[model samples]
Target: MNPTKNSKRKTGRVFDPDATFLSNHPRLSIMILLFLYTVFLIVPSLLYTLFVTPIFYATHLYLLHIINFFSVAILWSIIVPLVLGLPNKREFIEYAKDIKIARIKPVLRSIGLGIITAFITLTCMLFANFLSSLLTGGQVQFVPQLLIHPGTTNIYTSLLLGIWEEVAFRGVMLVLILKIRSKRFSIISNGLLFGAFHSVNILSGFLGAILFGVEYNREHFIPVLFQIVYTAMLGTFLAYMFVKTKMLLPCIIAHYLIDALNTLVILNTEQLNWAYFCFMTFVGIGFLPMIINIPLVRSFSFWFPEPDDEIIPFFDTFLVRKQRLKQYKSDIRSA
Candidate 1:
């Protein structure tokens, strides 16, 4: 084939959404359109809340899992490419490379961090319980009934759920939002989404979600355990570690450990009593890193990540967004 003939031939791959009818802010439109994907997770959950258990009794169908399965599909297959709009196979390949999926160093480091993260979370919670007992005369019992046996099925399911939730929220959703929004915006919004990911307005979830938002400006993404001022502060530390090292595997590891153990804790909450919750209210000191890095944090606000001095070659989701942002700027200019 002649070069000229081949050049003229159209591969016809890109979606190339028509720009003529779009508003002045095409990117905003894309953002809003992508936001609707939340409904895919939410509505099914609402249905489950309303009818799943009763229907199971009536028809004996394992219908509850449908919501879970759909949630996974929406996160991986749909939301992962929510903004790209019909990109070809090559585009996705490039995207994976851009996100540093091929890089192994940070991942290994993240795994290591995860081990430490679990201990940190456990210490915080246990210390909270201990303090609660000392301050308010609360009975801290190692009651066998309180600690549910860690069944294999339950552990596996919880771990699997943790991985999926991380992949969806931090992995895909964070990357997508970073394209058009600032890093802080991406972190905060996704953190809130992380909180709301439970399909309800849970306070601890909300705190946990925002905990990591403060670290994005440094161009690192972190994952962590739980909520409240106590959980939030702990989350802040976990997020800070990820940002400093540009490793995420640790966060994911920390996530499942916290989730699995926390489930046992939640069940035994009443036994430990409300005094325990009140005891945990004294707050945690996880944000000491920021205080130590105080000068850097002075100019920063809640959503902004404190800038760090170290320059590292590690590539993670934040870098992926930087690439996307660069590309978006080019598109906006051309338009």
Candidate 2:
């Protein structure tokens, strides 16, 4: 009996010498994946908030944002793929497909579809912000800090943020979860995790208050909580877009535009209270985008074929159910 064949039959998965040990253990791999991703993403900002910004003094905020951009880009774009043993072109392509970033056939059509989605989402976002401002009796004012700051930090940071986040959450996390669960489960799980990810801001605020004497109070908490909830819903939409488009670019572009616009303007109001927060969280971030983008994404389907939801790749083997493994071993023994 061939040992490798016997092993494959028992496990129901072809053995890959290069696959990481953790990849075979789904639960542990997931915990490690989230831990590492979160550490890399939040640590830089946290450190800056706690220590580096205070010491450096000038160019502090700019440096912090730049550091964040580089840290996120390097981790997701370069390090993760290399760690996954995707050195070969074909292997990398397969990895990309699994994550829904593959250059699907008819590349031009895909690019056009992505751009259209971005345009519609951005327009809707602006309208939502405007309506939110009007209803709250607030004025959307230019963010004076970003506007007065030197260089194009806002632009580049927004662009990189969009790329890094969509690639990390929608491209990678959502895809991995989808492999192991149903689409609804994967999408909702991703959204909740994404929402929880924003909770780090509370920590950052607390650190700032402790170290630099910045005020951290209930008012601050409210905004952070609102951000957590809003981003959660936004994450769900972004994941849906990835599913509908079968490409990651649309999500990235939409996220970038949203971030860039946010950096430009903020809702300013004399009546800054809980009522404002509640309205923004539920109506502005929640209901507004849903009303806007559903038709736009669907209308474009006729222009080109929607990519099938099926995502078969070697990673699927790593995520096999325990019952399947048991069945495979029992069949092999009987045979």
Model 1: per-residue lDDT, tens digit, 1-335? 69997765434222333422222233443355345545554565456645545445345323434455567555555544443432112244333432323233533444655665565555566667667667666555554342333332244445545565554455444544544455555555555555444433242234334542333321111122222344444444433433344434555677677656643432133343445544443432233322332222222223222333222344446566879999999999999
What lDDT is reached at residue 274 by model 2? 61
Error of 1 at 202 (Å): 5.5
Provide the lDDT at 279 for model 2. Answer: 58
Model 1: how far residue 234 lies from native, Å: 5.3
- Candidate 2 wrong stretches, greater than 4 Å: 1-19, 25-27, 46-55, 84-93, 104-136, 142-153, 304-335
Least accurate 10 contiguous residues by lDDT in model 1: 217-226
Candidate 2: minimum summed lDDT over ten consecutive residues — where? 7-16
Model 2 TM: 0.73
- How far in Å is the alpha carbon of 80 misplaced in model 1? 2.9
lDDT of 2 by residue, 53-75 (tens): 45574555677777888887777
Compute the lDDT for candidate 2: 0.65
